[model samples]
Target: MFKKLFLLILLLGLFNHTSHAQKRIGIYSLSTISSKSGHLFGLDSDYNGLFRAIPAYCVDYFSNNADFITIDRKNFQLIENEREIQKSESFMDGYVVGQGKSEGVDLICQSVFDVDTYSLIIKILDVKAEKVLCSSDKKMDKNLFGIKDLKQQVTGMLLEISSKCFENEIPVVRVLETKGKKARKVLIAAGSNLRLRSGYKIEIYELVNEKIGNKTISRKNTISSGEILKVEDENFSVLEIYEGNEKLLELLNNNTPLFCKPTTN
Candidate 1:
C-alpha cells in the first residue's frame, strides 16, 4: 500500500514538472506604418491602445494549448519603460530579444499594422538566438472591415506564429491540392526539402472564431489528421487521410484557414 501511494506522488510530481516546461512568450507594443507614406510612425495614443489589448488577445488564443505561457502585462510594460530609457532606434530586433530573455521568456513577438494598406505584420523572435523565427503578413479581407473584425484577424495571425515558435520539430506545410473526386488525399508543400517521408502522421488545424468569456477569440481547431503517403520532389508530398472524414476534405477544398503540422512516427 505504501509503494502504491509513493508511485502516485511520483506521477503527480512528473505531471507538474512537464506542465511548467512550456515556453514563455513575450509580446512587445505594436508599431505602426503610415498607410499613404509606407513608413513607420512614432507610437501614439492609438498605438498604445492596440498594444495594451494585444496581450489579452494573445492569451485568449493560446488558452487551450498549455505549450505557451505569456508574459504578464505589467512585466511587459516595465520592459517597454526600460526601452524608452535606452532610447534606441526603433525596429531593433536584437534589443527586443535581449529584453525578453532578461525577463525569462523564451520568445518575443511584435506586430506592425499598416494603416494605409490595411495589413497586419507579426514577427516572432527567438530570444536565445536573437534572430527572427518567423514573420507573417496578412491583409484584412472584406469580411474584416470592421475594427473588431480587423483585430480578430490580427489575433489569428499572431497565434499562428506563436504556435509555430514552440514546435521546432514540426515543419509547417501548406495544402496544395486535393486529389481525386472524394478529396481524401492532399498534396502538401513539404517533401524532401523538409526531410519528410512516408508513414509520418500530420495534424491539420482550421482557424475559427470562438467566443470565449467576453471576448471573441480566434484560434485553430484540429479538424483532421493524415499520414504521408509519398514524398515527391523537394517541395511537395502527398498525404492520405488516416483520420477524419469528408468534412475535413471539404474544409481543405474551401481554402479555409488551414495548416499542417508534421509529427515523427
Candidate 2:
C-alpha cells in the first residue's frame, strides 16, 4: 500500500512539472478596435463592454500557453449589417491620408481618411518597424481605406493599449532603432519622417510606380520595386532606385520634407 502511494505521488509530481515547463511565447488580443476611422473613436460609451472583454482575454491568454483574446464575432456581425447603411448615407468614404514626393522636390500633401466598418478587418501594423505587416478586409464593405505607415502606427497602438500582453512593457521591438551599417537607398512612405541619410533607419512605403493624379510620382528614373530601407545618415543623398527596368536616383535635396498620404476610404 505504501509503495502504491509513493508511485502515485511521483506521477502527480511529474505531471505538475510538465505543466509548469510550458511557457507562453505571446499574447494576442482581437478587440473591437474603435478608431477615428470608424467614427466610433471618441463619441460613444461603446467601449465599456469591449474593455471588459479585453482584460478577461488578456488574463486568460497570459495564463494559458496557446490562448488569445479576440474581438467578439458578434460585434463584427453588427458592423457588417450596418455597412450598406453607411454607404447609402455616403458616410463610409474616409481616408487615412498623407503625401510624398521624389527626393528633392517641394511638392507635398496632407493626411487623408478611410471609412471603417464593423468588419473583421485584420491590420497587422508595427509602429516600431513603421510598416504594415497585415491588412486584410474580410468583407466587401465600402468602408475601409488603406493606411500609409500602417506598421509603425500599429506598433505605437499596441504599445499604447496592449502593453499588458508582453513582459517588456515596451510596445514594440524597433528594428530600425537597433540596426546599424548594412543597407542602401532608403524608401520613405507617404507621411513618414525622412530627415535621415547615409547609413540606416527603418523605411516604410509601398515601392511601386503609383501615379497620384497626372504626376508621375514614382521613382521616375526606373527604380525596381523593392522594400524601402531606412535612411542611414544626415548628408543629402543622391539615392538610386531600381524597380524592374527603371533605375533612377533622387538627390535628398532639401526641396521637400518627407510625407505620406492617406486612403480615400
Against the reference, the lDDT scores of all candidates come to: 0.63, 0.29
**Total clashing pairs in model 1:** 1
Q: Candidate 2, overall lDDT? A: 0.29
Q: Pick the TM-score winner.
A: 1
Q: Model 2: per-residue lDDT, tens digit, 172-256?
A: 1111211123223433421122222222212222224668888865431322232324333332222222232111122223222
Prediction RMSDs, each to the true structure: 14.2, 19.2
Model 1 regions lying over 4 Å from their true place: 34-40, 45-52, 74-91, 142-148, 166-265
Task: Give the per-residue lDDT of model 1 (tens digit) for 32-63.
Answer: 66656545555553654655565555555444
